[model samples]
Target: MKSANDQATALLEFRLSAHRTLGPKERDLISHLSWRVEELPARQTFIHDGDKPAHSCLVLAGVVARTQYTAGGQRQILSVHIPGDMPDLQSLHIGRMDHDLETVSATQIAFIPHKDLNHLCAISQTLNATFWRESLIDAALHRAAIFRNAQLDADSRLAHFLCEMHFRHKAVGLVDEEGFSFPLSQELMGEVLGLTIVSINRSSQTLRSLDLIRMQKGHIQVLDVDGLVRFGQFDGTFLHQRFDHETLARAS
Candidate 1:
């Protein structure tokens, strides 16, 4: 079992990423949530499609991918979730899972039972609303991903994904002067962006050749922030970030 301090730190990260602020009561409620931690290896599929999950999975470490497979066995990645994300929170309301949730890297996750979450929401309106807002944001991100896949060229699509991850990692205090850890490999990037491996390679090469980004040793460093943003056609407004666009831009 992880110590209380570790759990508290994880909850704080979630609050910081989910909302700008939390009342003492809300924080207290979150602290009281009971969870069991699990360490799983990379490429592991813990939650299968159509499973009625009893707990919501909070990412304590590494990234999680929400994916679905077509009848012909082609995979489409719906979203990439990072630390502090309660990726299965929607399971509290929506009983059955529509897609599989898998780890992209060796991952540590805290599983909070649905019974506890339902009870907590029963008493706290603000906390309930906060969670509801988070689910809405999740939906918005999916829509954005769909738009990018349908409308943007391969290079621009990849650029947009890079910018989005940079902003999100920055918000959660995961970014540094050298940039943040991006766990997605080129093959995985192909899965997420709905492109072939060859196309993904071409797009990645294009971005690097243009001096917009550097991806080395599983980390991305933004060399030209403005150029990347313009190329990606990225706008942080839809992210519903607590910080303004300028703050996120400057941080990158």
Candidate 2:
């Protein structure tokens, strides 16, 4: 059985894994986050659209996506989150979820009560800023998605997402120039990229055959980084990873 201590420690990791590092006082607050660990199977919904959540779930392991559905029954994945991401961080103030947060892989989550966080934020400005920054980053991705989905071609959109995820993973030391773990299926990729599954498959093969990426055992090995970046037309500014490069290195 996982103890609360383990859960809190994982929360600390999640807090520290951000692009910006918290101060000592903020780190101390993370120790008092008051979290409970929960293991969930893949494809399980942690929170659904329009649901009110009293707590926020922090990913300790595995991946999740916030998904929204269109009136036509098409699903659009809003964001993909790795360990250390708080998919429903906005629910603290909003109270109700606007989208469904679902696991993409077998996941371990630390549920932290919003009441505790709200109280802590009232007292700790650093904690408040940290959480605020996270929300801003989330908004940045959404903004980027709107542009990328609207303007870019299917392959370019996928490329941009790869670059974006690479920097995000690097901030938390989950990836480097070689590659990163890619647990998403082609179908899921299609949903997120607004492409058909066949198009997604073909685009992936195109990138591979072009020697831009090599798919290793469940990992995407980026072979030609420059070419991939050019193909994707990626600009890392939207990711906000430049906030603290030294902090990212230290966290990694």
Clashing pairs in 1: none
Q: What's the TM-score of every candidate structure? A: 0.92, 0.89
Summarize candidate 2's per-residue lDDT along 1-252 as a digit string, tens digits: 657566556445555445455677776766766677888999998799989999987787788999999999999888999876788889999987889999998988888788888887898877787788888888999898888899999888888777777767766666765677877888888888899999988888888898888765457877887888899988778877644233323542
lDDT of 2: 0.78
Best by TM-score: 1
Show where candidate 2 strays beyond 4 Å: 1-21, 176-178, 243-252
lDDT of 1 by residue, 1-252 (tens): 758446644554455435647777777777777678899999999999999999987887799999999999999899999976778889999999999999999988888789988887888887777888888888888888988889899999999999889887776667778988988888889999998889988998999999999897678888887899899998877788775332322322
Q: Note the Cα lDDT for every prediction shown.
A: 0.82, 0.78
**Structure candidate 2, residue pairs in collision:** none
lDDT of 1: 0.82
Return the TM-score for candidate 2, rounded to 2 decimals: 0.89
